[model samples]
Target chain A: MKPFSTMKLAVAFGTAALAALLTAPANAAIVLGGDNGWEVSYGGFINLFFTQSDFDSQVPACAGPTCSEDSTHMQEGLLPAFHTLTAKSPEIGGLKGTAQITFAPDSSGSKAQRLNKGGAMIDMREVFFNVSGDFGTISAGRTLALFQRQAILKDMTLFGVGALVGPDGGGTSLGRIGFGYVYPDFRTRFTYKTNDINGFNLEVGLFDPQETTGTAAEETDTPQFQTEMTYTTGFEGGSFNAWAGFLWQELEVQASTGGATGDIESFGWNVGVDVKMGGFNVVGSYYDGQALGTLLFPNVAQSYACDAFNCEEAENDGFYVQGTYTFNGKTKLGVSYGESNQDGTATGAPESDNSLWTVGVYHDINSWLKVVAEYDHQDSETLGNEADIFGVGGFILW
Target chain B: MFSKINIVRFLLALLVTASWSPLARADEDIWKSGLNLYVRLTEQDDAASGRPVPNQHPVNLDPAAIANSLIDIQVWDKHWFKKDEIEEVFSPEQARLLGQQLAIALRKASPGQDIVFAVSRTDTKFLGFRDLSYTAGRAFYSNDRLNIIIGDFMRPPDKFQERATSSAGVMEIKYYFRHGRRDDPSDFESAVMTGDGVEVYNEGGKRRLDWLVIDVNRASAARLAEEKAGEEANAPVSDEALRQEAARFAQERREMRLEMARMRKEVGSGQTGAESTAPIESRLKTLDELRQKKLISDEEYERKRQDILNDL
Candidate 1:
């Protein structure tokens, strides 16, 4: 099928490229003791996938009319190769502090380019410090946003490839981003997380806002406000996690050419649940919002779709359901289906829809290594295109 | 309408309420008192020195060695106390009975092995019954010494009118063991009644003491001789045979080491994937099925098929 628009694809890839690197399991760190009770840890993983996709219609990657319908390449999957360093200070006055930094590099360039220089560049994704005590934790700096954080973390495709952006795309793949939920891209923020109370905890943060319209003179009088509430508990035979998150931001926009002057208020809410029983895991999530855009918050293209004189808010909603069963505690087989839709505004534009089906098998060779095989079928009603993608990869962590 | 000012006020109120909630108290309050017993068995004489190994000081016991030779380790927590507080919880009568049962089980399990039992108690507050005094008793066994250390809080001794803390009680028990052994069973009986800090007992003295007799000669001479003969028969004979046996032993050791390394990695990293013998074949079969169903073009299928074969 025809691929997503250039702006949408860019937003999706940019969001995933920055945030997906930090999705590696945190417990696999190699810790080293330092003087005065300071400890340092190194962790992260490298994964590469050989992917092939067959499309039903021409995509951006096709520059000629006689271009082939299939494209094959070796690239990073949903997650790029990550290298992280963390430093933790001993508890002082009942408060402990920690600082972490991470670098993510992709492997998606051509052979000739690789010979001349590096295959791809690196993205500094996480640089944050946290102070925690009986009062809970306060974090400041750049990190993954809280909205839809749990939904993406619980996604089975986090460990495998879900959807391909394009034939020659770099960075990371979109692991059910638009199909299942909006991407909670990483951003600089100040957040406070309360200590867990009977398995219930809350997180509230003020994030740096993004420009909705690239061509407009936009002003944000207040930071984007976000909050998430999560509850986790374990029963006799299994455990489950449930969460709800909310987002709100208001932007005063005036066209650079002095044609439009109005306010666009964006608001979104999402709820999700993950249940793990024995070796079986099931996940379901849904999100709804107005002027929230799809794929990423305040999508620039969607904002442009609005009338310049009087902006009419566009409504978006999506849901995803996934189930996975781990066999013999080592091999996991999963199936996921999700769809995202954006309804036309008052101007009466045709609504657009994106949906995908993913089936994957993840096998652990050992604690530090895993092999993954995935197949994805993606469809776009707006573009009237369909694509089938197959990928195989493995991950290695320190 | 959900206004920004209203939303901000609501979130602030929620945060304030959550922070002041009683359930948000320090997590350390979750700690509770319990009884733990560890038992290990080793040769009375040191293998390298060929001399009697000194008894391990209760606090200086090597946990790794104990784990390697462990006969048993039992923990009696609140869950067990809930079921049978009188019999399972730590008390003078219960401790004595537990000591008796453990001595019997170990003697039966390993005949002719020297046994030692050491017990120490720490006073603590128990959950749900904070008004009632509680003691966390830790007991270890090695060599031939059987020492039982009771907390003064259980039934405060007349000498220490004030309830003794855990540290003071531990020190008092250590002093009794260092002074000398009180091998007589009557010594323990009297100490228990008088709320003494320590009660010492040994396997020496009359075998029929306290209505318990451990007959070490359960295995007859005929059975012992047969076992000796089987051990000798398995011994290597010629030099060539000995060399072969040595090589086989080395190979087995290497395999064991590799398996242990793999297990350690798995435990450290987390869960691992299951073993699959023919991943390539399975992948090929899947690709063929997709092609048959026309999900992929013939050209695409051939290219993927070639790629899989190239890995071979």
Candidate 2:
């Protein structure tokens, strides 16, 4: 019940929570160009999974004396079906521009009961435009925020399900949001990225401020700032990618309304590395911050625990390590484990921890199709609940 | 509410119908009888052993590669012709050099005949009950020319392993020399051009062609020119088709302009205070030049001018 309550709250605030994997090769997409130099491309994938989950007895839904501890459902995995359209403009006066729009639709409805047509939902997760020239690129509009972006992108669960919220949960299943890292939930921001120099690039953005639930600190005059730096290099048979990200923001607690009027400073930082050699890949990432929330950045609802007279910012940290081996350029086997811990500021509040283990097998039928089978075990220490889920699915990409 | 069987039947019907379509018939006719071209494998050399290998004939090339390369060649050369499904592949700079080497081989083969050259890949596929051959590369001959068709097939896997991994496939050169009727009436009666195949040697992962010799006379050249001219004059465009084309062009132009306007907005907004105004000035000059050239109307130019000025 506790895990479900937290998950429901996350679902309510996390709009189209999954981020598109940015590591797919550019040539994999379909591009249409004309003699006039402008080009448009279309790319995305649709995936569906049949999953059977076994929940903890204490977390089962009960009707009278009857209790149900297991459920089977056809649903989307960590990623919803995505359809993205990108348009690029010809270079004019040394400046080139691109605009992208992505739509994610759930494969199943939210209702616990089947065959509910009206329960399906579509989320416009990305609507952004960017301009680039010799200097760098400046992006505007809503997109995946920068904080902890690399961690999720590098997670093997990006291609397979790692965690399940519930049998009939809406949107996309949570891969490792609460288990290993906080969701970088897409946000509206204006960011500038420097041109790659010696395989290193820096990006900084000013995001629309976030609100803390029940903190009475909604009034914020300063935009939240986020920045990330990454370095990439390759050897004869291997490659490496290392990244670091930082986030900072301040919230003003209104005294006139209730509680003490003061500024609560929230900050977070993360570092991650990914290495690939021949057929093997390894990734490790860690994050530490205050008021950052265990599941979502800035912990919109629980960033700070407030009393009638004062408020204290909560502390959160998490890490995940994963490894995978690809065989003959087609099939991949992977395993990963991660944990996230939260220290609430409310007096005598118990520390909460969430962890997950995922083992998966993914096979590419061709360049545009893939099949996946996965098993996941998730544990919520504070709530004394656990779940085991098994799923099988396939994806069609264009 | 179609049943599953009905859906399957519908799909099968579509496939069968497509195989018998007019275009499909044309493709078959062209590859079989359109031109009297012949391709023969003359030599197979092993690069690793540095010896002329024997008894290796009819090498199978990747059908997909041949089809793709043929389509690319036809589009690039603006010449369309279908040949027997043979096989081959290459890049542009290498293609240019290969063309030159092919031209030299044609000169040596025919001595005095004008030579027209074309490169293409070959494809073979099976229809429901018949084997259909498709050739996708450029093929043309004109003005007393010796038409040389260089059909390369996929290198044998064993042979490929002998060369560097970066090596492109071996190119087999088959040259056709047309003899005049007056000089060789018996040869002209056969309707098939006679040619000699050159030995293709693989040296350091590159293909080398030996010289070829064949006989050519002048009379057969004019006949092929007339054939090419007839093929060059395609069907005339209908008035309705012209209207549709014009409308599509107009729509594309309108979209390009709208895209340009949006890009200008993005560029203007991204500018920082410390940045120089040189870029804005340069853009204005470019806009004026476009107007002077009548690329953009005066009214459109003025609107854009105001937008650029607003950026300042």
Candidate achieving the largest TM-score = 1
What's the TM-score of each model vs. the native?
A: 0.56, 0.54
lDDT of 1 at A275: 85
Those runs of model 1 whose alpha carbons end farther than 4 Å from true positions after fitting are A1-33, A58-68, A110-121, A213-216, A256-258, A348-350, A381-384, B9-312
Clashes of each: 4, 4
Query: In model 1 chain A, which range of ten residues has the least summed lDDT?
Result: A21-30
Tens-digit lDDT string for candidate 1 (B165-272)? 110111111111110112222211111110111112223442211111111122122223434444544666566665565556655643454344333333334535
The regions of model 2 sitting more than 4 angstroms off are A1-35, A57-68, A111-121, A213-217, A255-261, A346-350, A381-384, B1-312
lDDT of 1: 0.57
Using lDDT, give the best candidate's number. Answer: 1
* Error at B209, model 1, angstroms: 34
TM-score of 1: 0.56
Provide the DockQ value for model 1.
Answer: 0.04
Deviation in angstroms for A322 in model 2? 0.6
TM-score of B chain for each model?
Answer: 0.19, 0.18
